[model samples]
Target: MAGEVRAQGAVKSGQLDFPRPLTTVDVVIFSILDDKLQVLLVQRPAGEGEPFPLSLALPGGFVDIARDRDLAACAARKLKEKTGVTSPYLEQLGSWGSASRDPRGWSATHAYFALILADASTLTSDARWLPIRDGKLREKLAFDHGEILASAIQRLRNKVEYTSLPAYLMPAEFTLPDLQRVYEIVLDRPLEKSAFRTRILSADMIEPVAKMRRGPNRPAQLYRLKKNSEPVYFVRTFNPPE
Candidate 1:
């Protein structure tokens, strides 16, 4: 019962003994670096005689009802406390509850997925951002976390194909190439630059700004999502690389 949650107050014997399954939250936070996708993981401390002295898993913990007003607040608090990451694009992925998902007791988790800019400087020493390749992660994560992560990855891949959700991963102003890189990273495929440009432009999800990003080479024109551009659904699903 390592991560089990107890009731706040004692239950009366004659009262209706309602089963209150322990509620918790888990976050799968993703970031992009060098056109590659990465996910943040926190190290779980080793207990005496455990086979794995240390293991990695998504940043999460039991929900503190007194401190957290809701499930999302608990997730955000745990993410910041465990990984020092805050203020990213977060969305509920799904609920996970199985008879044997947790070793402790009956538990239900409201899992979330977050998209953030890759910045190692913002993370704690115990937190790491690992690459996502071959449609999977390299580390042997703890508990049912691997399944949760895979679910989040699939959700992101599906969403990016139809929705303008990926814009949350970029800066306030970015070039088309930059946006394409975000897509390529999330989808794990090299996009046809011209075709990608045409598709994105035709959708009119973004608008050109009167700004340019200066670099060693020529300045690149900047663009941002239109303030009132509605998300387009039912588009063609993007194909992943073989």
Candidate 2:
């Protein structure tokens, strides 16, 4: 009799449950390429009844409950599937959902942003990097992705002011000048060299490698991010060079 009561309770709850929303995970992958901060976008497959046929969109897909253990897993899986690259820095941005966001049905999406080296992986033809000029995109994106991308750019720029985020966009080994160039590209301003060097060194996020990068003028010391190093948060934001 107790088993029957439990089954009846389950049925009652099931009947009361509202319709589930369409769930998906999307990732914004950023890299430095061509002296600009670029984002990877994939072309949506053209298909009959496709919502955004032949349009570019952020890499993402519906969550696979059987395969994805959680949102982050789903995000990493989608990132690899779309870009053929895995990022060293990935963070949850925010969630977006609405009845009007998707034409198929009520939909909700979990968004994540990631930083990667441009040369880390070869991108498939469907995926390509587009330059983000002035923290904005020129082309329209599919499925409300334009708004999502804008939010990601804002988040990344805001975090870069005080965090060691630009480090993830660097190659395995680089010089201090190389690292500073990346910071300027992302922040869209030049930082005081002495001040920037002091701040970065004091953070203890990177260590000098034995090797050096030979350049035209002279050899510069190469440094790599410390193993298992997390982003170092500075107490103050970077100020533009006077």
Candidate 3:
């Protein structure tokens, strides 16, 4: 079938009547820091008329059909090669291709989105996390990456309201307040502490660990995602009072 052929990135005769589109992958890596949502970007080598030449762009690269197992493997490899960081969670955003999107030839790209904790020490050289607010990212990231990033950000906001996707952005152990801050930042609104806690508990999204974080004021209990807790859409969005 065509689908199977595409999956294996092959053709029986190793030839085709028509030219196939070149396949590449792009990744949008996101993190939360200081209550601001951030994205990782890399500086591209100098080039002529390139939107991001000698400037920041998303970490990405072409797929190696001869070696890569699949599109995801290509994305993972590229992310490590360009950023020296691995994501705790990575999901396919979708496919995109514009006739003028790439200059090399007719090209199509499969976009991926990932969530990771903010820690510059974990990143490779020349990679940096930048804040996203009021269309600031669009001006910096190049080659339709701004559009790709906007879609990724919107997906996160929509998913966090009904699903447990936010767990990917959290540490192995976190307190209610810590989780709440992540939610607040992603949702771009403040949530009532009591309501947020009650909803999370009722959903059974996380389980308490015996350990507690020792802090300045009080000891906060640690919690982690419940085993086998798969993401599910809620009947209504979670909008706690401010």
Candidate 4:
């Protein structure tokens, strides 16, 4: 259910600390199809500490061993249940195992991040696609979500500079300029147009489309994401870069 996580293990305290066994998933969904970078959120229905009858949150749930063969698949299934769509790029964010992170005893959760298009009717909660800008998000995102969001953003920004993650958000075919924009968005700063072009072109991950997207003056070609397209290199840092 979408309620509290169940507590597990025996406590010498005598009083029952938590109820049943507990496990959870924290999902971070993002899409970049246009000018904006947006994340999916859902409103909490009434009665699950839901102050707002409809408030924003990520789609997630308890692990269902019966339905899913493994933890990752279980989390993915829960995400689909809550969001109404399947995630194309899902990965383990990290394990959140704590003695008392959950109100229920001995509870733990596994967080996962999903990358998808920013569209309607697909997010988990009451559902809304919120822009990444701080002011754009006024409502309180639920359950350690603030932290989770921050982590996902930092992780994404760091990944895009030299990695192919940008491909995850772009169409199969895209122009070098289009791919560059996604990179700029991730960097949170503009890259010199010429240098940007060289960076991606040299990587050689994208190709031109058969047809072009004609513009006001001339024809602009469309391109698609490459297969198994790993960027030339990744920035490695044991610690978060300053």
Candidate 5:
């Protein structure tokens, strides 16, 4: 009787695994260094139908239950194994397990995104940051990474305006000018210095740190995202255009 009840529950919840599907995860690692926004990509080796034998791609792989159901942890583990870098900000951006997203039999991969620390020059083992706008990126990837990349770019742009989340890409202490520079880089435009600073500070999403960053020109006060950080992630309501 209990077994039958459980079976009915599975049906109700759509939790039954009928055919085994190959599960995997792909991550889009991002960072800014030397005044440039760069992404980490792994070079695909010669393979069956992989377009570029030595092309670039984000680090990812199958989920390991032994590592726990933590999706971002799985991505970080795979990245360190494949690219040799353990980042501080790996997150499950969303799930992408559509049937057509993968060419391989019934396999589907979950894509994660991680923000990396600068100084990636040490990532020399077939892992490097090609500019997001690099014209040389024509390599065909394993899954729908091309489409995924496009979506991720839009997500980053949209989140920056309403969320102080971009600060994760910077150090614990940063100046308002530094923060605005990163915003411009991600948005790919020149933000009016006065207006940008005005809106950001008025948001009250960040608070001052005890540290001061000494620059070549002047010493700047450093600040960090405030403790009750929910205010920083405010998403204004919007109705679809009628």
Candidate 6:
């Protein structure tokens, strides 16, 4: 019977009989911490015959076909397992696949990037935040994760110039200055204050909350991302200050 072809490597009408490559989902989780753009990385366990043991890599694992409904579901499951926080700003970055990329076998990984408030999550013991310096990592990552991470960072910085993506890095309530600082941290340059404020407020991505953040000078109005808000794209990229 056609439905009886359930054996491993079984040949069906148009299905290939060869073994499948290793399939997995990887997430590049980003957050702002210590006034710097940081990424969450997990250390691989040390074991005999294990690939890249004791090396730091992005949080990911093999796709559980029984559990995950799709690529995005697998990404979210991996992210939540590692960070204990489900971010509202998860995006599909890209997919990387090659025989030489993984030592165990030919593997393909669907990579997703997420932005969350640093203080909103509790990381497992093996996971830690590492600062991204000058759009790169100082230490090498296991597998092709270094390349994946670089791509994620570049995508993030590029989008930040024209989209309200940085708002995902903010806490629940914050002042306009705080929001601007987060943008500057991700973009690695100072944005014009007046222009930044004008753009952010006009975009209608955020709404004024009832609270205020009291500072040394005076109380500043607090704002939160509007309910069910999506990142707002600007007409032009934000140019650096003159």
Q: Is candidate 1 or candidate 5 better by lDDT?
A: 1
The Cα RMSD in angstroms, rounded to one decimal, for candidate 6 relative to the true structure is 4.1
Better of 4 and 6 by lDDT: 6
| Clash statistics: count for each candidate | 0, 0, 0, 12, 0, 0
Off by over 4 Å in 6: 1-14, 240-242
- After best superposition, candidate 5 residue 12: deviation in angstroms? 21
Candidate 3, residue 96: CA error in Å? 1.0
Kindly give the stretch of ten consecutive residues in candidate 1 with the minimal lDDT sum: 1-10
For model 3, the stretches where C-alpha displacement exceeds 4 angstroms are: 1-15, 47-52, 83-87, 135-138, 240-242
Best by lDDT: 6
Q: After aligning candidate 5 to the native by TM-score, how far in Å is the CA of 86 from where it should be?
A: 5.2
How do all the candidates rank in terms of TM-score, highest first? 6, 2, 3, 1, 4, 5
lDDT of each: 0.79, 0.88, 0.78, 0.66, 0.67, 0.90
Residue 59's lDDT within candidate 4 is: 64
Residue 110 lDDT in candidate 5: 78
Which pairs clash inside model 6? none
Quote each prediction's TM-score.
0.83, 0.91, 0.84, 0.77, 0.75, 0.93
TM-score of model 1 vs. true structure:
0.83
Candidate 5 similarity to native, TM-score? 0.75
Clashing pairs in 5: none
Q: Residue by residue across 1-242, what tens digits does model 6's lDDT show?
A: 22332343336566676556789999999999999999999998899998999999999999999999999999999889888887558999999999789987778999999998879898899999999998788989999999999999999999999999988888888899999999988889888999999999999889999888887888999999898768899999977433
**Top TM-score model:** 6
Model 5 agreement with the true structure over 9-111: per-residue lDDT tens digits? 3343356624445677888877786676666778877878754456556677678878746776788777677556675566667777764665544567777
Residue 177's lDDT within candidate 1 is 88
